[model samples]
Target: MTGAMDKVGTTGGRKRRAGVVAALLCLVVAVLSSAILVSPGPAAAQQRPRTILDMLFGNGLDRGQPYRISPRYRITDPETPERRPARRTTRKAKPQNPAPKAAATAPDQTAAKPAVAAKKEDAKTILVVGDFLAASLANGLKDAYEDNPMVVVKAAANGSSGLVRQDHYDWSTQLAPLIEANDPAVLVMMIGSNDRQPFYGTDASLAVRSPEWNAEYQRRVDEIADIAAKQKVPLVWVGAPPFKFDRMSEDMVYFNDLYRQAAQRVSGEYVDVWEGFVDENDSFIYSGPSVDGQTVQLRNSDGITMTDAGNDKLAFFARKAIDRYVAADQTSEAPAPGARIDLPPIAGAATAVRSPPVSLDDPSLDGGEALLGGGSRAAGIDFEPSPRDKLVLIGRGTGHVDGRADDFAWNDKSSAVASDDKPVAFRGSIDLQKVRKEQGIKPPQEMPSILDAIMDDWSQDNSQAAGGAAQK
Candidate 1:
């Protein structure tokens, strides 16, 4: 009995020892697995962008292949009054005509209208909206024909902010003050940087290929155009600049095309800056000194923004556009087909001699671009247009070393941090409540001067515009 008991005890002791060994082995295996987990591969998971505005301002957006789509409709959402599902059904199309050859084309689709109805004059002064690109481009504009006195640079309204927020939020409210301070004849919009993603909204989404996003985007374009119409300010649509390393760079291309489409829809002009930045392969490349110098790395250290060479090219295109449009506008008193009646020309130092070869009937321009300016940079600002952190970098700010310039002279307004707010305005600011008091045009609210509300807001403390500042 003693021997059996002793044997049992020995076996139990052995079992206990084995169990301890098994636990230690498990611990060793767990430690090895953890070590492997800690060391990731050199190719880290690319980060997605923060704000829609960040696509331009923030760096390192995911470089996922962008899905291409037609820019005819906007992918942006509306600003205020959350979108109720689209209730209005499409109107039936009257498909009768085969071609207009029989009717002599009915007054030429692109011909200028009578002076009383359509504004054909070249815009002397212009205002811009959305992102630092507009501000930087506006700052860089030069009087191309100095002696002519016909061309001039006037007021500019621009900042960081995105299209999504500008349209959805009350960012458009910021334009009131700009209108009050300086009402330009032409309004240039180079938006789309700030809003392409979710900002100040429930959804944290990337705005590429998302149908839900496109609907909202369209609303924003509509609102912008509506305001321009109300103000009688001929709009010039400036497209977004190109950048490498930005995942949304592909998405930006999609958005840029849409801007062009919106311009046509509203009888405004569209300026495409993308073509200039892209390579022969049509791929985006920030110029570099390496063997792949032409490879599209046109971004700064941060993948989102642009380089100096890029901004200068943009400036040149915009300058040419301003010159082209202004020349046409200043011409005759006659109006265009889809334009409003002309108001008296502002008392400037005599209008410029019109540029010949400029088609009066059809500018033939979807805003033609001249890739002139190059090789200028201001400090952190690049001559190229790329996304900065919370700021889409476009033009070179006022002062920087001479070598940085790529083409045109550029400047930066954001010496400090970029404002989260971009300048935007909806229809008229006049008291609509009071304006509708009487019949046609006889309301107490002093005929809504599209300029009044914008002017008013420009001077007020627009902390609400930046989004973060407003929420706090």
Candidate 2:
């Protein structure tokens, strides 16, 4: 009984201690709750010391300004209200400048407009764009205009570029930024070398040299041309040259046709480079006349790209068009065709005069004929036959007739020895036979034919036959 009483006593003491401890814990919780309720809001809390997490989240952004959505509400100090400049009580006066005389006469001169004055740009920028060919073209153009301060040649070419492959590089998108940045007066372009290949469309690939492909390619070209038009820059589209391969050259020709059509649609200048690099038969040539008309290698060994000479030749076609647009002094009006211009005659020049003709019968034409006792030739009387008869038969009517001895009768003026045929000593005498005998040369005899000899032989044979028969 004593042991049970002691146990009960111990248990009661433990319960009492536990109740005291529980009462203490309740008081502590109540005190903590009251303190939390008395704490400030989030905005106030942000003003307190920050943690490493808060610092990492917005260490750079969270500077002196307080967190605000709108720029007007943003403040350097949370306690201070931002101050703004006071509204003007009176209007401020603008500074006055003297008006230009031109502006007075033409009110539009002072008016605002989008068109840029051409003279503002000291030099015309010739922006050349294309493939590798354009690099050569740019280089040639630079050399061509090296001495001219008014022209500046520049290049923005992309190698292996073309209108057929917009996916590779879209010229329409590229030209906007290009023309904007360059602000060129003239835009020269010579692509299509890399375009003849098959065109890969969205749904399907178009075959090379196909009508559909050509149409799409031309559309791309038109897009590029339109960019220049929008920029108000004159575009000089250069045609592709004839390539080494016959099919490639033919495709280039078609491409040139499309370029020409697109250029015309946009009112752009189309430069024909095909003719300059082709022969009379329109075949591709590796060497041709360059810008200076010197014959040089125009194409590379690959036949696709242009050499230095080739590029110059290609640029030459476009140069004139570019010059026309870029040169402010160039006049579009041509002089009237076939207009006669009278120039002052040369000084001290004599007028042409006609002199009378001196005939062969004239004594003046005969040098010393009177001193030599020679008579002048008769002009009206013609002793010789017609020139036609003399040419037809040489020495005609000179031969003597066989039967008549007097066929060629001589006049009394003809002595035995004619004045022409006489010896020097007997020129006025008539002893010509003695001179002939002294010379010991026989006169010419008649030419004998074999027929006479044959007849004589036949008669002799007939006589011999008759004599033989009589003897028998």
Candidate 3:
């Protein structure tokens, strides 16, 4: 029974020893897992450990160093949705009316307001009369003098009226009334754009551009000028510019000629705007250099009407004549014709002495008889004519040099008749050897040819080989 008890105790001690070994292995495994979990990544692996305890614990030394965690590794709180930015919607509300918007955006308010403010009570009126083109000219003139309070542009134009359509709108009877009403300081007229039709009469109608038609047109134009002259108003007749149609432009040219004659006859000025609208070849153009020198469209798409820029250019040509009259009215008053003034008496007139007149043909007037440099020289000096003087006065030339391009003398023949004089020696050749010796130039050494150089190399190699064999 004692032996049995010893065996059982030995078995129990063995079981306890196995349990302790298993517990030690489990502790070692737990320590290894904790070290791996606390270790830094490869990037932080280069940092040194602060202490041996830190190395064992796998805590890398990051003291006093910046540590940034990547956003992918950052933990976000699920309860904080308000921290995110809200998205913006793209929907917009449409307006009910567009006209008010367009009216609010109307351009050139600064320019429009000043023009209205500049029209003073004492401003001088510039009366413009004609067809639709004259209406455009009026607008351009208004723009030209918008800032000048002293000048005012007024339009009395009839769009469908012309000299040919007297029955429709007669300018001869209507102009006198306009002049009296406006009492303008200057009268500007530009007609003939709509006058290319036949003139209807009581018995027979005159065809367009016919001799009878031209005579009647000139008569009507003359009558308009006469009315202005009678009213004592300054007239400025602006010529018609070229049109898109070739035939229409030709008619305008002829009309401009008549307008020029009539305006000149009345002692008035003519403004020719033809060259301004045409190109270098005198052909009609749609676009040209504007007043600011920038290229802009001058004519509308129809090619008959003018754009805003075109109207400004038309007024540019007529502005000078208009300004002259406006300036004349503003000029200071001259002295009255009957006014008289006392004049200062002439001084030192009675005792003044006069010198006798000299004749132009007298040589003594120039202080000598002979010409300059032709007077007598010193007694011992000799006077010889220079080569230039010989060539100029005697028509002779000096001798030419030999072998020159101008020397036309034959090589085998004498230049002058043979005389009993000795022949001249030729001295053109030179001795190169004597020149080289005097200059201390040495002769160059000759170099070996390709074949001779190869033979010399082979000979040297064979002699070396034979000496090596004897030494062996």
Candidate 4:
């Protein structure tokens, strides 16, 4: 019996030891699981790892029971269907009549305003003709009026051409057709550089400074002037500029004078480009004042053709006359955009308010009421001419006769007859007697003509040439 009790005690002790070992093993596992959960996991494992405790107690736990839910995490009672308001099924009453529909689409009757205003007036055409100089002038004028909507500049200049070269180009024949075709408001003509050469007259080939040459050249000039006059187109004739060569410059001066005379005869204005391209001493200059008053190179190395600045300056001179004659006529009190035109007020009509004129005198008139004087003379009374006012004839005979004492061929104020009763000398030093002797011609008291002056210069140049040749 004691031995049996000892065996039973041994078994009981073994069972207690096993329970204790199992309890120690569970505590060690719980500590290891808590440490693993508290510490950081492997970087590769983004998700929570399946723990041993979770696997053991996952199905056994009653986590959804009321006692298990914490006060902070507890869900409120679900909403009852009786507490919510029910939707209405019956529809509201419809209106008796619908609002009237807008009127049907119709075509617009009122005229729409123009997208862009039409031009008030056609652009005035300007026809330019001559040699290369005229071409340059045209270019400069075009640039000057580029922004102006009223001006149209046309270039019709032929290079290395002139009135003297009819075989090459006939201006008299060509100009009429050009005028008819273009119908230019203004005609600008410049020539005579190539005209320094000999010309062929109707009868024969004439010398450079001969009488026949002058007559023939004058006739050709008149023909061109007549063409412009027939069309009633205002002419602006530009004269030749002074050249670097003495002989050439002298010839140009003569040509300029002839051009001036011809222009005046035809009621045209002559533009003397000589002074503009000359120095203080009246000599050829390659550089001069431009249109903007800047000192710039004016001529090419050839000494005849013009630079851009030179061309602008040339056009500047011609532009003045163009403005006065061509553009001035178009200047009137035209109504501006949105401006009202003045008209007579009618009876029982609302009087239109208008700004008073800037000046009491009419701007269009020369002197307004001061000159009109109630449709009569303003300054003085009219003087009537009697039968004796007829022009008195200087010569007694109807045929060739000498002038009387009272007859002076020209006005007394002319410089042609000097204070000393002798003709005025030429502009610079070239003694008249010396010139006459060089040419084997007789000296005269009166001033020499353009032809005579040119002949004298040519003769002096020839003598110098002969002397230079003899010395060589």
Q: Against the unseen true structure, what C-alpha lDDT does each candidate score?
A: 0.56, 0.70, 0.78, 0.73
* RMSD over all Cα atoms, model 2: 25.4
TM-score of predicted structure 1: 0.39
TM-score of each: 0.39, 0.44, 0.48, 0.47
List residue ranges in candidate 4 displaced over 4 A.
Answer: 1-121, 201-204, 328-472
User: What is the per-residue lDDT of model 4 for residues 1-472, given as tens digits with 9 covering 90 to 100?
Assistant: 9999999999999999999999989997887676556654344233566578545543122223222245655332235444444554899887899777666655555546423322236778889999988898998888766655567788899988898889999999999889989988889998888888788658778898789888888888888888888889989998888877899999888888888887788899898877889999998999988877789999999998889998888887788667645553233556789998887542211222463444321243333325321344336543332222323434222222223343334455444443333434433475655554577543468988999999999999999999999999
Best by TM-score: 3
Q: How should the candidates be ordered by TM-score, best one leading?
A: 3, 4, 2, 1
Using TM-score as the yardstick, the better of models 1 and 3 is: 3
Provide the global lDDT of candidate 3 against the true structure: 0.78
RMSD of each: 40.7, 25.4, 33.1, 30.0
Per-residue CA lDDT of model 3 for 1-472, tens digit only, reads 9999999999999999999999988987887676666766546666653556445553542323323335544333335655544565788887777545566567966767533534667779999999999999999998877776678889999999999888899999999999999999999999999999998989999999899989988898899999999999999999999889999999999999999999999999999999999999999999999877889989898888899999998898898778767732222336789878666432222222553455442324433456544555668654465555555665454554543434344354342223213122222466444554587435468899999999999999999999999999
Evaluation by TM-score, superior candidate among 2 and 3: 3
Residue pairs clashing in model 3 are: none
Comparing 1 and 2 by TM-score, which wins? 2
Which whole-number lDDT from 0 to 100 does residue 457 have in model 1?
A: 75
What does candidate 4 score on TM?
A: 0.47
Candidate 3 vs candidate 4, TM-score winner: 3
lDDT for 255 in candidate 2 is: 82
Quality of model 2 by C-alpha lDDT: 0.70
